[model samples]
Target: MPDGQEVHYGDYVQDDRVHKAVYADQAVYESELDNIFHKKWIYIGHESQVPNPGDYWTTWVGKERMIMSRGSDGAVHVLYNRCPHRGSLICNNEHGNAGKAFRCPYHAWQFYMDGSVRQVPMKQGYDGVIDYKDPQFSMVRAERQGNYRGFIFASLSTEGEDLETYLGQGARAAFDDICNRSPQGEAEIVANCFRIIQHSNWKIFLENQLDAVHPSITHHSTGDAAAAMQKKYKDKTGDDAPMGYQFLADFTLPFEKWDSLQTVGFPNGHTQLTGYMGLRPRDPVTLAHEAALTDAYGAERMDEILSTNVHHVIVYPCLSVQPPLQQLRAVRPLGPNKTLTEIWHFRLKGAPDGIYERALAYYYHVNSPSTMVNADDLNNFRAIQEGLAMVGGGDWVSLHRNAGQDTVDNGVTHSVTGMSEMPMRNMFAAWKQFMTEGN
Candidate 1:
């Protein structure tokens, strides 16, 4: 509607800003689904979610419904969830076992875990007219799929860079860091997730992920309250601060401190904000966990693993990963202004129970919908959506903070300051390329 096609996206070079219409435009949303979501390698679900054969998880790649399941052969497959007959969804539930075969509830047509046709009931109805062995009757598998570690992704378009080539160096760190935390070099889903439907464009949610400037402002009240409670507890007991309280207080980190941090922009739309939460305190629980890590990985390797400083890694258009906290939120855009985010946490395999509990604490306290931290961010997202809906309000959003200060090295852009809008610019750079280029 805003002549987004005529707007040579590259021509909108601003010292520190972009047109606000990019967030609210319906045409832009459609184009994004076609170009970015369809063309890029979109994350589906972790391979571990469907560990056993016949286990499947239904998810979205843009608006398409797909089932990510483990076949009887133990290989992961992505299949369109639609039944070949009548176009009914074969898998109704979000995730469950198909038990060696998936049967369509409509006509009772059965399919194997790999989407191969297994049986068709009422065989005599069309014996001569129809061919049972035809691939058309089978559930369609995704054209391309690739896995990095145990995280699985599928591309709708057949032509593009393979998963590893597309991820480049920047996006790989998200999965690598999460896995390396464990002494055994692995992590597993904590089972189930907190699914939140947000009243905002998906991009609005992603933009906030690496947005270093907003926490101190948007979450100030929540952080301030948590900090006060922490001080009071310390005053009353003369004991150490609670980890939960400190987690919330992290939102109130000084602006300069935030500015001192770094958010890296990668080749694709992937981006990461780097800063350690100081999670490892001298408390017995922490020290014990450290000792376990030291015992398993030795002192130097253990320290390196424990000292990995990653606040958030955003695999653009879909995932926001807080690897250090074993937390990830996957964004599924449903409409121009509707997004569903699946909030999931992971346990470092073989890690201490206390460490796992720490991850769970952060999962519920900071990332869950019930938490003040999340509520505050959601409110901002909704407000931005409403503001962008205004007809006469504005044309562009500003990504100007330290805009020109970012330096690109080896194709990765590094922010001069933590609050730099480099992350937004970096994502849009990828967005423009995906949208305008056919490949």
Candidate 2:
């Protein structure tokens, strides 16, 4: 769709490294919006966010505005927000009950919750000039729509794999990890979410999520402060600091420890980071929650479930999910150097209140707009955006650390070193494939 000089995929992304233009060039980003995002099953909204009939939430699928709404018949539909007539936004609000039908504000053209045309004023206005009965006159829907465990996604193109097949094992496992933890076998979205539009490319945030080396280096101050407070609390009260401190303090972990952890680069550009947080802390609240999980699933099954230790997973091109902590950040790229992230945390249904509190702390302290942890990351992302735009700066962004040490099997790459650039390389590989082969 974008036919510009720099849209050539080979020039920017390579086997082990990429050009800075991949992040800095407007042409490259536009190509991604068409080739990758529109062609693939981009995440739209969660079904849980619009549980009841007539509920709707507006979001973006690539550069196109979309509305994920539940119909009166209780079926979910992902429709383009544009009205068929004159291209006015069909659902203007971020989220609301469309009630019986969606009435476009521009012409008052109405459509059902499922996006079928219901009413248009003055049928005589376009008797022979337009075919009102044509399907094109209706509120247009996406080429494909999918719902996986309550998470919804849409594809603007008819080609490519079904969502389940597209996500593959690793990306699907990220959702499984979140769902399996709840005593009710579900995670419910909290009432609200935090949204921040960063001054950098969307890929930068997703890359940083699995970049083990940067956390300790970029967030050293916040980490050090939390670590110091933990010790001070121990000295003052003869008790360990609260679990919340560990949220910030983990960034102070030595490079040796970071290297000891494992990172799996899955097919389709997805990647996972293991061993950042020791999530299953033995405490009164956690013990109570464990009892609930154990009761829901037998002891052996509970152990089998809890034994799957994953800190975070990058759901390539769309989401960064921390299944263990019940949080997910969705990436929406606005331009080459601007990105919007929706920060949301979920409550494991049927778990204790204290367990939710633990999750709440992580959401507010680490992901919120006001937190120093996020501020630090924002600072660096902005700085990199500015630096890459410079004329004479270095051409390449290195993904060379542990470059040759990664092992590949069945299209997935496994990192020999925790801080390996395997994830970046893996993503670019997927990027290359998507852009070139259109798969």
Candidate 3:
């Protein structure tokens, strides 16, 4: 487990498997909410989403309603989205600029963009009863907030590791890669996101993110169909097929090649699988994109940036981030069995038109609701959850593949084979720490 000075909760979890109750027990789920979601810093939204003062977006840390917004003075603040006066929600909309401040719709109690109390209509009524200037009467801000590059995260608990420490070595390069590709070194949230509610445990989705062994099986049909279409398109046009088509087909990559890929298990339950998608086609748009990247970061740096082969980085417990495609899926656990995942994609700030188009295509085709790829995964997750809930199910879930073979260096674990269960083990390792720590 992690060698932090603080007591480790992960000692209870064994290396190769975890107790089945971790998934099906309500008490464990509640504990996870308190320890993992409440204690750890969670990604809310980018500062770019609310670039202007008064702009806010509402999200969650467990069941707690939280808002990330830009204050009047331009600093970003993450606050609980509840009105202190009567517990009315301060911000009802998913995202929008509040003009200057937030006004609760139910009671009309207002708060500044920074969550400070602005007005109380019945202040005279409370003049003799209570002190309005007290912190309890003001809208509550998140206990701790931090940002990495442009990505912002908030922690409900005042204790525990800071954001940089929490991200450890597993922080997504997609942020640095995307933002640095721009002349200004920044990326902005483009409007809203595509939200999805999965009828399964949130862990299922997180575990699948770095499971290099699943795509070729779960998405084989979509991949085979895309491969067929890709070949047909090239045969007729006598030129390279569109990258998106090949991107879909690559889902059916041969087992041997899939096994050869690598999954890196970083500290704090974060894990990443490397293998770049073959999305660069020899088309006018792609050529233009290459030129733009070369112009912005120079050819050597551009090659280094584009050559980054990260497929997915599972920021354990809350997010599955695909930085290469500017994609993030924020996990919200609804119950022991139900979870909601918000699928969001971003445009690289100051990048070329074709670059954004490539990301958008992947978003729509692979991650979007209409995609067969997503539907297949959702169905599998639901089935797995149902199976796990059964009385006849096994007591422990296995993560035994290449379990003892993982090599550790500087607290990071690298699976010897792509099919290794190192990702799952690494996550459970953190889970144990979170669940058992300080209890």
Worst 10 residues of 1 by lDDT: 5-14
Tens digits of lDDT, candidate 3, 1-439: 1235552335336878776667776777888999899889888888888889988999888989999989989999999999888898888889888887799898777788888878878788888899777789888999999999989999999898888888876865546656765545677776657888887778888998888789899998999999898899999999777667877887888878878889888878988888656645576765776677788878888777767777788887788888778788889888889888888888876677777787888888888879878889999988888887776656668889888999999998888988888999988888887877776
lDDT of 1: 0.85
In model 2, where do residues sit more than 4 Å from their true spots? 1-7, 124-131, 234-240
Total clashes for model 1: 7
TM-scores of the candidates are 0.95, 0.95, 0.93
How does model 2 fare in lDDT? 0.87
lDDT minimum window of 10 residues, candidate 2: 1-10
243-266: candidate 2 lDDT, tens digit per residue: 779889998789998899888988
lDDT for each candidate structure? 0.85, 0.87, 0.82
Segments of candidate 1 deviating more than 4 angstroms: 1-15
For candidate 3, the TM-score is 0.93
